[model samples]
Target chain A: MKKVAIGIDIGGTNSAIGIVDEVGTVLTRGNIPTDRHSDINLYIDDLAAEIERIIASTDVELDIQGIGLGAPNGNYYNGTIEFAPNLRWKGVVELTKLLSERFNYPVIKLTNDANAAALGESIYGCAKGLKNYIMITLGTGLGSGVVINGDLVYGHDGFAGELGHVCVENGGRECGCGRLGCLETYCSATGLVRTAYELLGKSNKPSVLREVVNTEKLTSKLIYKYAIEGDALANECFRFTAEKLGKALADFTTFSSPEAFILFGGLANAGDLLIKPTKEYMEANMLEIFKNKVAIKPSELPGADAAVLGASSLVWKELSK
Target chain B: MKKVAIGIDIGGTNSAIGIVDEVGTVLTRGNIPTDRHSDINLYIDDLAAEIERIIASTDVELDIQGIGLGAPNGNYYNGTIEFAPNLRWKGVVELTKLLSERFNYPVIKLTNDANAAALGESIYGCAKGLKNYIMITLGTGLGSGVVINGDLVYGHDGFAGELGHVCVENGGRECGCGRLGCLETYCSATGLVRTAYELLGKSNKPSVLREVVNTEKLTSKLIYKYAIEGDALANECFRFTAEKLGKALADFTTFSSPEAFILFGGLANAGDLLIKPTKEYMEANMLEIFKNKVAIKPSELPGADAAVLGASSLVWKELSK
Candidate 1:
C-alpha cells in the first residue's frame, strides 16, 4: 500500500484539499466552501467527508498515515486556530482535535500557511538544502515565515514570524491590524492597488488603470495584466510595491541574515516587473555586510501545487521530527 | 582542584580576563589594553601571559578546562574575529585558533559579546528558566542577542542577531557602520549623547546641558544627572531616546516575538528614566496582538560580574553540548 498524506489549505474564501503521495504527487483534489459552515462541528464533519470522497475516488491502495493543514491562524504548538479574522470561525477552535477525532489519525500537524510554504520550500522548492531562508506570501495580505538554524522561528508566542505586520511606515498607512505603516499596507496585492490609487490620484499621468479606477471590479490581477502590457500606471504601481518590499526586506535581513528569500502567492507572479525593482531597492537599503548576499526569488514550487505540497510537507517534517 | 573556565571580554579600548567557576563566581580578574598592540601575535602573547599571571597570582589549584572569549565581530562558526571596526584588528583574525594553540585548550569557544551576554542571562540572570528571550546591551553601541527555543540563533553566516544595525529609521542618523538610522544610532549610550546634542542644536532651550554642549567631555552620565535634577532638555533627550528605542523594539518584536527584552549596559542603568519611556513608546507602537504581550525589563545580571560571567557561560554551554 502506498503511504499518503492529506493536504488541506484553508483560505478565507475556500478550502483546498489534496491527497498527496510520498513523492509530492497530488493523486486527487477537491474543494469545500469554508465560509458556509459557521458551526465548527459541522465544518469538521463536512471536511472529513470530503477527504473520504477524495480518497475513495482516487481508487489507489492509499494508506494515509497523517494529515497536515495550513490556515491563517493555525498554531503549530497548539492544535487550535485562534481568532483568524479572515475566517468565519471566531475564537480559538480546537481544529486538530475535532478533525483528528473524525479522521482517527493522531499525527496531525498544522501551522500558518506561510510557515507551511517555508517548509515546502525547504523540502521541495528553491530553498532545497538551504538551512536558513525566509518565505514571503504576497497575496491580498503579506504573510511570512522565517527559518533559522534549520528550524522555523515560532517565537515565544506561536505567532513569531508576522513580517507582514512589521511597521514599514511608522505612521504612513493605516493597516487592518490597527497598526500604522505595516509592511502589508504597502507590499501586499491589496497594498499594490492602494498604491496605484494614491499614485494616480497624485499625478495626471495617462494609463489603463485610471479607466477602471472607480470600479470595484478592478483588482491586482487587472493591474498585473496592465503592467505586462506596458501600462505606465500599473508599472509604476509594481515599482512602488517593489520599492516598499525591498526596503522592508533589507530591514528583515538585519534580524535573521537569511541565505535567501522565497516569494510566493499572487503578486510573486508579476515576475521581473516586481523582482527587479525590489532587488534594486533592497540592495540600495541593505547593510554593507549583507550586500550581494541574499537572493530574492519567486517560489520554485508550481503555483497550483504549492499550497498542497506545502501542507503535505508539514506531515513529512513532523514524521521526521 | 577547582575546575574553572577563563573568560575574556574584548572591548575596543581594553580586554578583561576572569577565572570563573561553574556557579558564576569570578575568582580572579585582570585587564589589558586592546588597542595598545596593532600586531596580532604580540597581542595574543600578551593576553596569554596576562592570563598565566592571573592564574599564578591566584595560587589556586585550578584545572582550566576551557577558555571562552567574547569580542566584537566574533564568529562562532569560523572562530575568527572578522573586520571588527572598533578593534585594532583589521581583517579576519584567527582569534580562537591562536588562543587555543597558545593555551593548549582544545575546547575554546568564542561568540560576539551580545550572544555571551544572552548566555549569561539564561544561566545566571533573570532569564534562568526562560526558553525564549532577547538580551539588549545599550552601551557605546546597541548590541543584541536573541535566544529562541533555548538556543542562540547563529544564522547562515554566524552573523545573525545584528539588531544594532537594523535600520529603524530609513535615512535618519548616520551610523558608525556607514548605515543610516540604525537602532544603535538612537538607543545606545552614545546615541543618548547624540540625542542631547541634536536637542541642544535644534532649540535654544534653557537647560544645564548647554554648558557642556560643545565640550568633548559631554557624556550620557552627565545628561542622566541633569535629567534627574529636572533639566527639561536632558529629560526631553531621555524621552526622545526612549521613543526611538521603543519604536525599534516594537519592530524587533514583530520579527522574533520574544517573551521579554532584557536590557544591559550603561544607558540601561539610568533606571526608569530610560526604561519607563521606552516601554511606554514601545507599547504605543506595537501591533494589536503583541501590545500587552512583550515585556521590556532591565537585566537581572549584576553589572560588575555580567561581562565575565556572560563570556564564561559560552564555555559552559559548549561543554554541555
Candidate 2:
C-alpha cells in the first residue's frame, strides 16, 4: 500500500483538504465553506467527516501516514492558532489537538499559510532546489514567505516575514492592518482594483474599464482582460501596481539578498503585463550590486491545488526533522 | 593545554589582532595600521607577522587551534574580501588563503564585520541564550548583524544584513552608497553630527553646541554632552536621531521579528537619551502585532576587545559546522 498525507489549507472563506501521495499527487480532494460554521467544534467535526468520506471514496489502496495543516496565524511551535482576525474561532484555537483526536496519525504539523507556500514551492514548484528566495502570494492581500539558508525565517515569536506591512509610501494609504503606506495597499489583487478605480478617476484615458457599472465588483482578472486588449487605463493600473512593488522589492533586497522572487496567485497570472514592469522598476531602484541579478518569476504550481499541495508538503519537512 | 584561536579584524585604517580562547576572552591583542600598505600582498604579510608576534608573546601554555578573520565585504562562503569600499585593496583579495598559507593552521574562517559582532554577542554578551536578535554597531558608519535561529543570515551571497542601506526616508538623504534616504544616513555617529548641523540651522533655540569652533569636527560625544547639559537644540538633535532610528527598527521588525536590538558603539553610550526616544518612536511606527514587544538595549561586550572577540567567534561556528 502507498503511504499518503492529509494536507489541509484553511483560509478566511474556504478550507481545502487533499489526500496526497509521496510524489505530490493529490489522489482525492474536497472543499468546504470555512466561514459558514461559526461554531468551532461543529466546524472541526464536519471537516473530520469530510476528510473521512474523501479517503473512503478514493479507489487507490493507501496507507494513512501523517497530517499537515496551513492556516492564518497557525503556530508550528505551539500548535495553536492565536488571535487570527479572519477565523470564527476566537482567541487561541487548538485545531491540531482537536483534529488529532479524530485521526490515528502520529504526526500532525501546522504553520502559517505563507510558510506552507514557501515550503511547497521549494519542494514541488518553481523554487525547487533554490534555497534563498522570497515567495509572495498576492491575492485579496499580499502574503510573503522568506527562505534564508534553506529554512523559513520564523523569528523569535514565530511571526517573521510580514513584508506586506512594510511601508512603501510614508503616510500614503491606510492599510487594513490600520497602518499607513503599507506595500499591501498598492501591490495586492484588491490593491490593483483600488488602483484601477483611482486611475479611472485620475485620468481621462479612453478604455473598456470605464464601461464597468460596478467599480466595487471589479476583479483583478477583469482588469487583466481589459489590459490584454490594450486598454490604456487598465495597463496604467498594472504599471502603477508594479512600480510600488518594485520599489519595496529594492528595499527588501537590501535586507536579505534573495536569488529571486517567485510570485503566485491571481495577479501573477497576468504574465508579462506585471512581471516585465515589476522587474524593470525593481532594477531601476536597486543598488548596482543588486541590479539585474534577482529574477522575478511566476509560481509553476497549479493555481487551484497549490495551497493544498503546499500544506501537504509540510509533512515531508516535519518527517525529515 | 588551552586551545586558542587567532582573531584578526581588518578595517579601513586599522587592523586589530588577538589570541582568543573558546570562552570569548581576548588573551593578548595589538593593533596595526591597515591603509598604510596600499599593496594587498604587503598588507597580508604584515598582518600575518603581527598575528605571529602576538601568539608568541603570550605566556600561557597554548595549543594553536585555527584562525578567523572579520573584514568589510568578507564572504563566509568564499573566505575572500570583495569590493570593500573602505579598504585600499580594491577588487577581490584572498586574505584568508594568504594568512592560512603563512601560518600552517587549518580551519580558517571569514565573515563580514557586522556578522562577527553578532556572533560575539550571541556567544559572549547579553544574547548568549537568545537565538534571534539584531546586533547593530553604530560607529562612524552603521553596521548590522542579523542572527536568525542562532545563526547569522548570510544569504545567497555572504552579504545579507545591510540594514544601514535600507531606505528610511525614501529619497530624503543622499547616502555614500549612492542611494538616497538610507537608514545609515540618519543613524550613524557621523549621521548624528549631520543631524546636529541640520537642527542648528532649523532651530532658533539656544544650545551649547553653538560654541564649537569647528562644526566639521563635531562628534556624537559632543552632541550627547550638550543634550545632557539640557541644551534644547542638542536634545532635539538626539530626539531626531532616535525617531529615525526607531521608525527604521519598526520597519525592520516586519522583516525578522527579533526579540531585541542590541546596540553598540559611541552613540549608544548616551544611554536613555537615545534608547528611550528610539523605543517610543519604534513602537509608534510598528503594526499592532509588533508593537511594544521588541527590546532595544546596549551591548554588554567590552568596547576595546569586541571586534577581535567577535572575529574569533567565527572559528567556533566553523568547528560546529
Best by TM-score, which number?
Answer: 1
TM-score of predicted model 1?
0.97
Provide per-model DockQ scores.
0.76, 0.77
Error of 2 at B266 (Å): 1.5
Model 1: CA > 4 A from native: A214-216, B214-216
Candidate 2 accuracy as lDDT: 0.86
Q: What CAPRI class is candidate 1?
A: medium
Query: Candidate 1 residues A223-311, lDDT tens each?
Result: 99988999988889999899889988988887888999999999998889988899999999887767899999999988998898899
RMSD of each: 1.6, 1.8
The 0-to-1 C-alpha lDDT of every candidate, in the order given, reads 0.88, 0.86
lDDT of 2 by residue, A9-117 (tens): 9999999999988778899998888888778889998899899899899989888778889999888787788889998888888988988788878788888888889
lDDT of 1 by residue, B1-321 (tens): 998889899989989999998888889999999999999999998898999899999878998878888998899898999888889889999999888788886478889999999999887788887878889999998888989889898778887888898777767899987878888989998898899889888989898888777664889999999999999999999999999889888888878889999999999999899999899999998876677888888997788878878998888888877
Interface RMSD of each: 1.3, 1.1
Task: State the TM-score of candidate 1 restricted to chain B.
Answer: 0.95
Q: What is the DockQ of candidate 1?
A: 0.76
Off by over 4 Å in 2: A204-216, B211-216
